[model samples]
Each structure stands twice: as structure tokens, then as C-alpha cells.
Target: RVKETATHKAGAYATVTVPAGSTATYTVTVSSGGTSATGSGSYTAGTTINIYAGSRSGYTFTGWTSSDVTITNASSKNASFTMPAKNVTVTANWSYSSGGGGSSTNATLSDTKVEFDKNEVDDLKVTLKSGSYNLRSIKNGSYTLREGKDYTISGKTVTIKASYLDSLKEGKHSLTFDMSGGTDPVLTIIVSDTTKTDPQEEKPSVEDPVNFEDVKSSDWFYDAVNYIYKAGLMVGTSDTTFSPYTDTIRGMIVAILHRLEGSPKADIANGFTDVGSDKYYTKAVAWASENRIVSGYGNDIFGAEDSITREQLAAILMNYAQYKGYDVSMRADLSKFADGESISPWAKDAISWANAEGLIQGSGSQLMPTGNAQRSQVAAILQRFIETITK
Candidate 1:
């Protein structure tokens, strides 16, 4: 409290009062595998407060948990939120990957069946067994559910979004869970209606046709490019040109794989001297490096801008498959290719695995291991990779 005194010429006094502003407190914590940035502090309401989760070696950051506060990117290791009028606590979740000196185990989710009213907005949770696993996809007959938009997973709980439930028809539907480990679980969802109502026909959604001038319908990579574009994995260099012949850079490939994982946040700086700090591929490169997807040139260099060769792409993709806990034991007899003997020793296993998986095919009698890969070739390889795993 403060007090003021004033005297005028006629010995009269007037007083003005002022009050101190209020502030909100914020606290951040990490469950494991990382450390939170020093975000515990008091700030004025509506102030933008930054939070960070610095991941330790061998641990992967999952997501953030905050009840009342709305984080800008809850899944990012580095995120921000506005300070509310009251105190808030944010916790970051992290997990250990197999490569991080952790033993692997076969895990599965418990099959669950639930019935609810069509107007109900409660989320459904599925129990996950003890193990580190990733949700590959959710399938309902021929329809696939999109993560984040349709559902979200945190730790052992898989929450079926209320919006997704409300969108379903009043009938029994089975959602098959495609997990990375053990047996896949099935979720039986039965939406019921309390009152009789006429069934409304859902309008079919029309997909825009791919119209890249450089990618003609007769081109060998036409379907691959179309798949890549539709999957939201790649885009054209221009509005009308796919630039199919352009050389794909190392950074671009890393960025594509990052997108395939929904672009999980990696706030830590990747120790690549060649990779720029503010480039568009910075976060993607960091995430890839942390996941052991790409190991660049020695001496702390990633060569993000350099064009990636066939062998390099194979090696990177192989590492990625292994990280995803996919079966990468398949090997092809490279002796069939004439120049197979010329393939680099370090990438031999990767090249063999890629060939066996039909992700990379040779032309005529040459494997072209050292040749720089074109955008079209990469698109084809990625399409084949996706098909092989989804099956």
C-alpha cells in the first residue's frame, strides 16, 4: 500500500490512488527422458510464455499435457502458450526408443467395445500394454482415420475424439488398430440414436485432380507422383510443374520423412555444421537426427543442401524403417546387378534391403548406386515403401 499527501495554496489537499498489476504463475515439468526449460515464472495475464523440453540421448519426446492452458504446439518439444489469469502446470512426456539402449518388447492394446448415443461427446480410451509402441493407423473398413484430426494418443491411452464419434452414423462400426508391435487390436464402436430420424445421405467428397505439366499421365512416375501429392508428402516446385527431373537434396528427403511422422517437434539443435539454423528443414533435420534416420558426413556435417545419391537414400530409408520397428531383415542378392560389386561397403545392407523390398529397382543391368536420385525416382521409391509396410 502507498499513501500520498499534498497541500494547495488554500491548505486543501486532494489524493489520487493507484493499484499494482496482478501476475499469473506458470510451472513446467517433464515426466522422463528430458528436461524442461526454466519456464516457471510469474507474468502478467495474456503474456506469451515459451516452454521447452530438452530431450536426453536415447529418449524421444511424445507430447505435452496441460489442462487449462492452450499450447501453440502441444506435440513440439519447444512450444508456447499464453499466460492465463490463474496458475498452470505443463508436463512433457517422453519415451525411450529401442536404439537408446532400451530392450524391445512385444506390446498390444486391449480390445474395447463401447456403445453410446449419437449425440454423446465423450472421448473413448483404449488400454495399451506395457511396451513402447507407435500407432501406425486406424482402419474402419476401407476408411482410414487421421491422427490429431480424428484421434490422439498420449502414453498408454488412445483417446477417440468426440468430434469423430459425432460424425459417425447410428450403426455398429469396427475400427482396427494397426500398431507397430504385437497383435493389432479392434475397437467396436456402436452409435445409437434416441429418436427416430430420417437418414441423411453423406455427400461424396471430390478430390482435385493432379495437374502437373511435367508429370504427364503417360509418364512412368505418374502414379507415384500422384500418390505422393495426395498423401501430402511432396509438392510441386511451381503451381503447374512437378519438376520431376530435379535432383533431390538430403534436406528435402529428411523433411519428407518428418512430414510422414506428422512433424513431431524437436527443439534441440542438430549438431550438423552444414545444416543452417533457420532453414525450412531445420526442425525436420533435428527430428531425423534424433531418431537415427540420417547420419551425415563425419566431422559434424549433414550436407543438407547437397544432392542425395541412390545409395544414400537407401541407407537413410533403411534406418528409418528400422526406427519404425518395421521388419528390415529382407535382403536381396545384389550379385544380379552388373555394377553391384561397385556399391559402397557401408551402404551394402541398406541397398540390399531396399532392393528386396522393391523400393529401388535397377535399369537394364545397372544399379546406379552412386547416381544422384531424381524427384520422380524418390516419389516412386516412397510410394513403394508405403505400400510394402501398409500391407
Candidate 2:
């Protein structure tokens, strides 16, 4: 018999390796203070074996197994026995420590799971199909949009709830999506009114002499003249010459406005010494000053005879739009016009807004904004204004 010695205080483990083709029974013994206990396992050659503590005064056994075995003398004071043919290696592990308490050797396992639910109604989408031009004009009732309706997204098989749908005039509109606190992409959609007539192509009727013979008789001025005329905003001179090529003067323009407003009589004393009470445009000039439409040229002199320029016309139109409760600020962009820097400071915003909103187009790339505004240009401006409000 081969002999090996293993010493453990209590609650410990001892491992023993036996040689192949070895047969024997092995025993493990533990002692603490004066108490002791023993356990044994039997195995044949070519097998491994292990022995564990059975019972003792103050001890336990953990993780011990037997596959090969050996026998040894079990009658010695703290003496360990071993088998020579097994040539086994034995290891003793102690659990009882000097100060730290004991702990379990079992391991813990962990796992996680994920789940999802399918939704029936996925999204809602909205689009502006038309009326982009009128919508931007800041004019009321000229353009309308559909309201309080529902639409669906077809390709994705998703149901959309549209609280409102607006009927805008024919044009390109943008589509947008609302995704429950998430970002929704945008798409462009076209809305059209196939039945609408082309106002530009409509000829001036020969029977309506008062409407057709004005300086705005040509088709180019038709829309502008009609709109201003229908609104009672502008009128022609006594000679019936709309004077499409003639330059508009400051005093004449004011008189036209006074007439458009029903020629409201002025009670205040004339502020300009140069304008006499008997002058043809006296009432109009005085009223214009009172209404903040026209200011003096300099030193209280109202240059009523000077021709109005393109820039000046733009300023007046924009101001009129504002007075009518339209917000022209959105179109403000002075830099777009080459002559923007030359415009009067007071008229800058109004002119820029008019140009940007397509209400007034520049003469070529350069705006020639400071140049005299002829009757034809004025007619065009008026036509665009009328079309905007009517649409």
C-alpha cells in the first residue's frame, strides 16, 4: 500500500487520482479538536476515485466524486492511507477558516426575453395639393383650402385620419406625415383645377368701352385694370386716355385714390402752401397727406406734378395691402432687386415684398425701380392684384 497524508480542519474536500488497472478501496478521514469521521469509495484498475467527509462533530462535505478507487489503513491518528498500484494524487481543501465565515459554492444563471405587438392603424398624412400661389399672396377669400376631411395611405396599407382637408386652387402642394412624436418625411403633390379659365387669354370686350379704352385696354393690362376698376380702386382721366405710355404723377395718383375711396371730402385746412384750394388735385393731395399716403417733396412742398417711379408704385401697393389687413412682411427681400439699394428707405420693405411675391416683376434682371412707372406697367400691377384677390 502507498501512503499519503491529508490534514483538514472541518467541512473540507479531498481529491485522489488513482492509476489505471488499479483496484482498491480508499477512505477519507477528518479531525477537529478531538472528534473525527471517515468516508470510503471502491474502484478497479484504470479508474479514478475521490473520497469525501461522511459525518463529524463540526464539519460538512462539498464537490467530491468517485470514479477510480483504492483502499488504505483507516486506523491511524490523523493518518491518510494510499494505494501503491493506483499511484493516485490527493488534494485536500479546507473550508473552516481562522476568521471568515463559510459560503456556498453554487453558481447563478440569468436570461432575458423581448416581445412586440402589431398595430392596425399605422399613420395619418396631410398634403397641400394646390393654391400655393394664392395661399402665399396674403389675400383673403381669393384662395380657399378643403377642411375637415380624412384620407388614407394606399401603398403601405395604412389608414390615415385627416382631421381637415382644404380645397386650394390648382398648383403644387406638399405632403407631410405625423408620426406620434416621431419625425415624418415630406412629399410633393400636385393639385389642379382643369375647368378653370385662363384669365390672361380672355380678351377685352368691345361693348364695354369704359372698361376697354382706358390706358389698360391691351390684354396685358386687362386683369389689372378689371380688378382695380371692379374694386372702385382706379379710374381714367376725362380724355379717356388711360395713357398706357404716360407717366403717372404724384398728385394724379392721389386723386385717383380719392376717387376710389368715393372722394371723401376733406375738412382739414390744406397743409401745403404750394397747393391751392382751387387746384384740380387739391382735395386729393390734402386727403393723401391726412391719410399718410403721400408726404411733401421737401420743406412742405408737395411735388404733385412729378412722375411716380416703379419703386414708388411698389411701395404704394404694398402699403395699400397692409392697410387692408394683409401681412406683406413675409415677402420682404431687398437684395433680390439690383437697384434695391437705391430705393427710398421708407419704401424698401414694401417694394421688396411686392417683388418677391410675384406681384411685381423686375424689368429684365435689373429692376430699374427708380425709373418712371408708365401706364402699361401700372396696369399690369393692377391686373395681378385683381387676379390674386379673385382667385
Candidate 3:
């Protein structure tokens, strides 16, 4: 039996017996086109449970919904709601992104401090993305530093000159950069005094994504690095460095591809003396070898550390496409390129397959097939590869 208590009555109260809690089950399921994730909950009725919507690379979570109307509020991709009256199963829907770049209008660098002495001819770099040029101004209460005369901008990297530092007195300094296409930077440069002996390194109160010494926003592959890193496909050699210009190894590419394929089981034995199951790249090598995506150098040896050429990347990616049942047809004329004949015999078909799909644009007039790809170049190509497959 239930009883109505107070209806907007002040100081009025009524005693009643609350119903016992019932166990409710919730399950999360995806139809397709999403990284597989597990979501299950068993909670008492009327309890609030949070449902987090997750997505894979190149995909976005739409929302969550269930058939039963008993479950109210079918909105919010990541939200909490009351337990339904009965068993409920929620479906996660996903949609692909257009794979384009987005720049911030008000993006600003986090506040930071630096220690430098006068007469020290050195460079102090600050992280920035491509967009705005022409520094508006630099102010620090009593003094200011001019852009072209005091500092220089190279891509997304900002280098403050020692000539400017020599002019400033020792103390805390705050500078505001007025950027056009990019976000303004809110950085603090600490001019170390001539007094004392050693100066401690300045640290950020919180970690910033753009703090990588080598990765500035102005670089062409900046967005791609963030995309791939966040998607769990790649990582930096260190927290402070991405080494975007470093040459990538063949084994590394195989491992990245395997991760993109959801790290499937290694159905076939990978016959490579150089790569053992104990190594981290072992599973990736196995998957690549089983699917004919890549083969070792020769004599049961996989040159895991050898530099991977541009043509090799093309071939492996093409093989991956075919393995995934994607069409690898070609209709483009490769003979038009000046260095077409330089392509290796075995890699011709793969290169042709990729080029016809508008995936591999030649370097100037040359195909540069044998040339190795830089880390930055790999990120750009990988981004395009995912975009192409999704389309």
C-alpha cells in the first residue's frame, strides 16, 4: 500500500515504507563500425548509473538508446540515468568524421616559466599551431618586446632572442601574443637574475598537450600526430619530444597497422628469426605475415629495424586493403611520372593500386619510391589511409 504525503506543505511530513530495491541488468552493444567495448551493469532499481559512450579512431559516438519506453531520457552520449524497471540493453551508435582540420580561435598556451641569463645566445621555443602570423604585441607591465625586432616565428615554433633577454631585468614576466589564425599564447618568461649560482628548471602546474619540444602547431602533421596519438595508434619517443623527423622502421609500421585492425589474433605462425613472441612487435608481425601484408627480408629473417621505404608502405597498405575486402582496382596512368621505372618490380602493382586511389602523390616530378618516409610524413599518410578506407 502507498500513501500520499505532503503537497507543497511547509513543515508537513508523512511516514511510508519504501519499496525494496530490485536488481536491473544493463548491456551495451554496437552494431558495427566501432571499436569493441564492454559495458555491463547490475544495479538496484531507482539507482543512477553512468553510461560512457566510447568510439574508435575516425568515428564519433552519436548517442545511446533502448527500445523500452520505461527507460526515460534517451539522450546524452555519456550520461547517467535511473535504472529501468526491467532488464535493458542500450545500443551505441557511431558516425564517421569527415577527417578535416580544426583550428582554435581563442586557443592559448598554458602559463609557464623559464630561466635564462643575459648574454646567453640561445633559443627558447614556445608551442603554437599554424593559423595566425604577425605578432600583435608583447607586454610585461613596464616593458614590452617587439615581434620582428625581438623574436622570430618559424612555423609553429617561437624563438625568443637573447638580444631581447639581455635588455630585460631579472624577475617574473608575462607576455601576451596576439595571433591571427591561431590562439593567443599566455606564457611567462622568467628572466633569471645575475645574482646567486644555479637556477632551477620551471615546471608547469599541469601537463599541456602542446608542450612537446619538437611538435609545434605550425607543422603540417601536427593535427595528425594528435589524432593518431589519442587514438592509441602511436606515441612519442618521450614526453617532451615526438621526433617527427626521425625515419620510421618497417616493423613499426606493421605494428601500427595491426593496432588499426583491432589487434586481431595471430592465426598463422610468423616465421621470423629476428622477431620472437617475447618481443612487443611479435603479434603485429604475425598478423601482418599471416595476411600477406608483409614478408621478412629473406631466410626466415625479418629486418624489423631496417628503414621502411615509401614504396614499401604503399605495398603493405594496399595488401591490407585487399585483405579487408576493399577494392584495390587501378585506373590511373603511372607512366606519366618521370621516375616510374625506378619502382621495384614487386611493388609496382601495389603502388599503382594506391596511386589510382589518389592516396600517394608523387614528390615533385619523382616517385621517390625507394626514399624513406619521415615520422611526420607517416602520420599524414596514415591519416589519409584511414580516411580513404572509411570513405
Candidate 4:
């Protein structure tokens, strides 16, 4: 026999008991035009879970619907809901659009999973598809990440700091990036044990190798130097030394670009008196001047021996991109950099475009627009330009 007392009153509080060991399963499905939806898992009752919707090619994400639970922000590509005591499923809707969405666009992350060695200090770089978007928030479960402290943004790339990754325990973790104008992406981070040896490091491959004594495999610009060297875009100062730290001269830069252009003969002579006809860079200067890729310093003289500044290099590359009919419309907001105001007015657009395209990654919080670019730095910039822009 059971005895209980019940009172019926307005605004009365009632307590409900969920059975021990009970779990709720969350599942997500998509409509005909949709591809896949994330955020399906088993969780305890009353746990809030994030759901992100994805659309197939030639389709755009519309909205979401749930028959059993109330979804928060159903119209957004990323949404959330509290898990009920019973199993529930959410459905993502999509529509077809044949026309291209121009500047107003949706973006996707380049990768869904990333790995980090506990002892390594390399930041986790996550790239996004071509679009203009702002990051709203980054969440690891219920915890919110603070920018600059946890991560930094450059163009469409989000770099999670190594300090933050090192703090995480050695295991798998998930982070959700909520951004505007696109699907909010989730990243799975696998933190590896520092004590364990990586077998790949035992015998490194030497294909298309650069045997410069100064350029080590551990250097940050190693691959870039190797790439430019093997491609015949740049060569070492000596057979033994690459002089990676040496400042690059204007003539050298033009010569490299001329080599990239197949070293075509100039139809007319360049009007610069300083560039001699017998010099190695004379044809390059002539070709560059004829193509309008560069304009020598104001007084009918090309300072061929002068060290090229960061802004000048950016402008030259921008001019080259324009000549090649590549898109130069994308521009990044340079206000984040401390020295943004220092960029020359003439090179403003070029620097902005280069920053947005990841061609000129500035020193921490400083663009250093007036600083001279070094040989290794130029090699890295050329590598980025070729891999991203030309490809």
C-alpha cells in the first residue's frame, strides 16, 4: 500500500525524478538537399548540446526543426537545445540556389580534426573557405574562450595558441567556433603524449632537398627556401650559405619575378638611368616597367641596390596579381595591428589585400610596413603566393 498527500494550487513547484542510469540520445538528420548535420550524441538529461547544420554542394542551409524539443535559434546554421529525458532528433532544412553568392557568403572550416604534440609549440591553424565573416565565440563544452588569450585571427585563419593547447590534458577535446555568415564549425583536438616518440621523426625524407648548411629542416622557412630554390625562383648567396638573414634588394626581387614570368625579353628599354644595360637585372627591370608592375623612385632613377621595404614588396606583388587577372578585391581590417597607421597611403590597399590573403603575415601585432624584408621572409611570401594565389 502507498500513501501520499497532494495539493493543487496555482504556481506550485513540483519535482520530477529521472531514473538512475537513464541516458538521452540526440540525433540529427538533413533534408533532401542537405548533406550532413553534426552534434548527435548520447548525453545525460538536462544537458545542453550544440547542433550545427551542413548543406550539400549547390544547396544553401535554410533552417532547422524539431518535433520533440524546443530548439534555440532554429534559423541559424548553429543551434542548441536541452536534452530531454527521452530520445530526440533534429532535422536540418536546405534549398537549392544556382546563382553564386558573392561577397555575402557562407564559409566552412578547412579541417574538422587537429592534432598537437604536448611538447611542440606550433599553434593550431584552422583555415576557412573564402568569405568575409566574424567570429562570435569559441566554446569548449560550457566554457567560453577569450580571444588573444586563447587564440588569434588573421583573415579567415584562426590560430589557437600553443599555450592554451598545452594546458589541456592529453586526450581528445572538442571546440565549437561560432561565426557569422556561415555554418559554425566544430574542431576535434587530439593532444598527444609528449613522452611517446614519433616514428616519422626518426628518418626524415629528403626529396627535392635544399642542402644549404644554414637552412635546417627545423627552421620555419626551410620548406619555403627549398621550394623557391627547387623552382629556380631564388638561389643561395653561395654554394654553402643561403644568407637567409640578408636583406633582399629591389633588383633581386624584380629578377625573381622576371624568372617567374619566364624571363621574357622586353620590347622597350626601361627609362631608369641607374639600371645599366649590362647588369643581370636590366631585362627584369625593363620587363617590370613595361608591364607597369613597378614604378621606380620619383626621379627617373631605379634604386636597384636599395633594400625593398615590406610595403614595397606587397605593392609589387599586388601589381603582379592584378597583371595576372587575379582577384584583389578582398581586404582585411588592419586596425588590429598596432602599426596599422604607419602603412604608406600608396600601399594601403595592397597591404590590406596581402594581409587578407595570408601573403604578408605581420610580426606580432605589428605590420612593420617600413621594415626591410629579408631573403628567407621573401621566400616564404613567394611560397604562400604561389601555393594560395597561383594555384
Best by lDDT: 4
Q: Count steric clashes of candidate 2.
A: 28
Give the TM-scores of the predictions, in the order they appear.
0.50, 0.42, 0.46, 0.48
Clashes of each: 0, 28, 4, 0
Off by over 4 Å in 2: 1-219, 226-240, 386-391
Tens digits of lDDT, candidate 2, 1-391: 3433333334443454455444464333322322333323333343323333343322333323223333332222232444434434333323432133344222111211111111222233333222111111112222112122234434333232321112233344343332222233333434333444577544333334454465444466655555555555555655455556778887766776676456777656669878888987899887767656667776989877889887777776665554333445556566766776888887677677777777778866677778898766776676665456224
Best by TM-score: 1
RMSD values for the candidates in order, in angstroms, are: 18.2, 30.8, 21.2, 22.4
Each model's C-alpha lDDT? 0.76, 0.50, 0.66, 0.78
* Candidate 4 lDDT score relative to the true structure: 0.78
Q: Write the per-residue lDDT of candidate 4 for residues 28-140, one digit (tens) a residue.
A: 33233243455654555765666667556655778888898899999998787776777677777765453334334555688999999977778999986634455788877
User: On residues 172-260, what C-alpha lDDT tens digit does candidate 1 reach at each position?
Assistant: 76887877775677878887767555544121111465899888878899888988888888999999999999999999999999988
Off by over 4 Å in 3: 1-210
When sorted by TM-score, best at the front, the candidate numbers are: 1, 4, 3, 2
Model 4: weakest 10-residue lDDT segment is 2-11
* After superposition, candidate 1 runs with Cα above 4 Å error: 1-208
